[model samples]
Target: MGHARANGDRRVHHRVDLDGRAVVFQRGAHVGQYALENLSAGGAFISGERELRPGHLVHVLIDFAAGNPPMSMTGSIHRVREADNGVSLAIRFPVLSADQEDAIQDAVLRTLLRREEQAARLPLLVFEPRPRVRQEIEAEIRSFGLPVTSVESLDEAVRELEGEEVEYAGLVIHSATHDRASMEVVEFFARTESLQTIILPEPDGELNDMAKRLSTLPHVSVPRIWSRSELRRALRN
Candidate 1:
């Protein structure tokens, strides 16, 4: 089972195929076991023996076999339709905490990477305050045939990193107008072993001192982005 979409679908979150089992419950009574077909951060589709009507509040324990404990959540039945084997129940999660959302995203991303071998390479993250510089960097990164994601602020980048399970290959940070708090966040990402981070400073030496301090950090590169070759070499390294 997969996403049940119609013509001209306008879904916000894309669904991923999931193969697992769940224990269904309704009205504080145990119903039966169901097969988890497809899943997204917001909802999932499960096929069960008994027919469950829409608007029925249900609890499910998703067997995410990624070394973590099973995910238990409460949701309501959004819709129901006929399936090949049994009836399918569309479950909609109305509420999710930050940890819960991260767990689901991690599970989904793991499943996708397992299915596709080439998906291990994560996209490049560009954190630039200047709009023109951000656009230029994104274009240059794309020219290298690499996928990139750009964020205007450090907070936005942090949110994206925490909310999604996608790993980042590298980070290009332009810290011209960023405050101390933002610089601290950049340094945190720079020191991460999983990503290669390059810090670009303005011509006025705005971030020169910070760059010098972070020179001793591992996987961190300081480069002048004005020179195309220097920037390219840093990204490649």
Candidate 2:
């Protein structure tokens, strides 16, 4: 069993406890393979020899097992602590591409679902005004074998949430209009501490301001969703 200790951690993204292997490289040269103790879309904790120091830039290839493709990304060591056997290095991915972020989210979600079989079928609530965007998000969530409740308007989503007794795994909101109705829906979920809220804003649109404001709330993520992969990553987060 993996142990999780978020006692004093102040990370924006939630970390999922997991165990995996990753190949660490520096300057295009192979450094060593280490054991990944915990992971989130933004960062990870790797245990290995205390060779890398804080602020050391490196590329990592994480193997998620079973036939899943390895996830590769560049990051810097944020912190390092001495462990019983070796050292635990906190690696932060300052810049993660949409695909890379999605891969990390997928791996973390898989581990979480596996650990809690009851949550495997948890429903995801999606509110997007655009038909194309709504369909895209619904398809991606369905691909994970989870149920999705997609609505074109914030009012409909709020009605569904209030009417249903189902526990949602997360909520994705993409509003191009960012009208008062949408802000109310965002505020509703913001007050609900149990749900993870993700806002996907259109580039250079009014939604940007709302995204920024909502991002200040706890368990809320505002990722730039200019492309499909980016939207998928935001939804997963």
TM-score of each: 0.46, 0.46
Question: Cα deviation in Å at residue 106, candidate 2?
Answer: 23
TM-score of 2: 0.46
What C-alpha lDDT values do all the predictions have?
Answer: 0.76, 0.75
Clashing pairs in 2: none
lDDT of 2 at 230: 70
| lDDT value for model 2 | 0.75
lDDT by residue for model 2 over 24-98, one digit each (tens)? Answer: 999999999888888876788988875688999999998875345788888999998998878888999886655
Query: 7, model 1: CA deviation in Å?
Result: 65
Q: Among all windows of ten consecutive residues in candidate 1, which has the lowest summed lDDT?
A: 1-10
lDDT computed for candidate 1: 0.76
TM-score of candidate 1 versus the correct structure, residues matched by position: 0.46
After superposing candidate 2, which stretches have Cα over 4 Å from the reference? 1-116, 203-207
